[model samples]
Target: MKDDKLFTAYIKSAEHHFSGWDFSYITDTGRMQSELLPWSYGSMAATLVQNCDAFLDMGTGGGEFLSKLRPFPEVAWATEAYPPNVPIAAKRLEPLGVKVAQVEDDTTLPFDDNQFDVIINRHESYSPKEVRRIIKDGSIFLTQQVGGTDCIQINEALGVPANDEFAHWNLHFAAEELLQNGFKITYSNESYPAQRFYDIGALIYYLKAIPWQLEDFSVEKSLEKLYEIHTQIQSNGYFDVRQDRFVIKAEAI
Candidate 1:
């Protein structure tokens, strides 16, 4: 029954978002390929898999984390806020029996109380009230968030304002918020290592995809910025893109 609703939601969302042009390019362009976005997120979801079953992958973009979670064959359902995320994710998660929820509004999810054993979010934005209700006590809520100071250099190079207003790694604040709401954090891992990109074009595409970065949307401006990055990377071996991310595996009381 849950799976049925998920499919219905995904289709409805697709119908709504398909009104625009080819969104496939967002995830399927250039040498990078949108499909590979998940691996870069992290492989730490494996830790939760060994501990629980019946997973919920909120904001499961292109089902990238789902790729690493093949071992946990528990009943799995995914919720996505965007319709564009469905068709792209289906290619990776459909064969695995993962159903997609296509609801666009950001409300509490349509899950029963205490329904899932292991809840996962790879940058899925969820409300505190919603997460509190659906996740069971003793179950794990695993999140992979943008590292603090995620991509300041990229923004600076493009003359864009860089700040952590809504950018990634803001989850640490959110985690604290969840804690205040009666959750206990059992594990917290954060890393700030050098994440590299192949070339300048890839870096520019990354800028477009990453939220919270300044973008003029002007073709000429973006082109000029791209040229600058290209020259810089060509002079250097590759761009030293700083990747900051945090992992929190908390237990709901």
Candidate 2:
């Protein structure tokens, strides 16, 4: 009966609305946590931004991360592909003089050729050709991508199929693609860090928020699996999984 009540509570908590790309609510609870990589993406972006005259932030969801790096260049722009996050990003960035544009997809950018001196993308998809067209000669492009195998254990535990669309997404492939697109790779690194879920609620919340984790994830459909995981957590105190991430820094030739 106690386990049943906990399950009910977790299911109800996971049904809340999640918007934008912010995961502060989950992270703050300390119920869901992931190990950090050795390199700091924010510091790297800040250093590059200080040297560039114009900058662009791709997939600047809710302008959460970009807004922190203040004293922006005279021209700063941001693009968000998710419809729900467009206005949220605009609201947070417009006052700071950042132009936020909504893009239907990552393949094409709505900017003119050689428009930006520095382009920063975090967990956003991009077209190599499109990036080459918008970045000025000798400009820099830095991106930290989420790898294909991130959190595969969750899918395995839930008995759901993993998304293999990005199976080839890694530091090597990304660097090669950028190099082929006329960019000289300067730095590349990849890491597999461990993530832990302290409770079933946190796991459900994460799967719900990150739909791609389990494309068709639902409490009703996965209740049996969820129950099994809940039992495991009860005995082990937490469930652990690995998270894949990679970073690349390149300069346009």
Top-scoring candidate (TM-score): 2
Model 1, position 8, has a per-residue lDDT of 34
Q: How accurate is candidate 1 locally (lDDT)?
A: 0.64
lDDT score of residue 81 within candidate 2? 87
* Candidate 1 residue-wise lDDT, 1-253, digit = tens: 2344532332233232331123343234432332123233345566665456677888877776576677655578887766777877776787778877766654658788888888888766667667778888877787777655776777776777777566544657868877986689987767665656545545544555554566454324665665656556567856666666666778888
- In order, the Cα lDDT scores of the candidates are 0.64, 0.90
The most accurate candidate by lDDT is: 2
Off by over 4 Å in 1: 1-44, 50-53, 167-172
Question: What would the C-alpha RMSD of candidate 1 be, to one decimal place?
Answer: 10.9
| TM-scores, one per candidate | 0.75, 0.97
Give per-residue CA lDDT, model 2, range 144-164, as digits (tens): 999999999999999988898
Cα distance off (Å), candidate 2, residue 44? 0.5
Off by over 4 Å in 2: 1-3
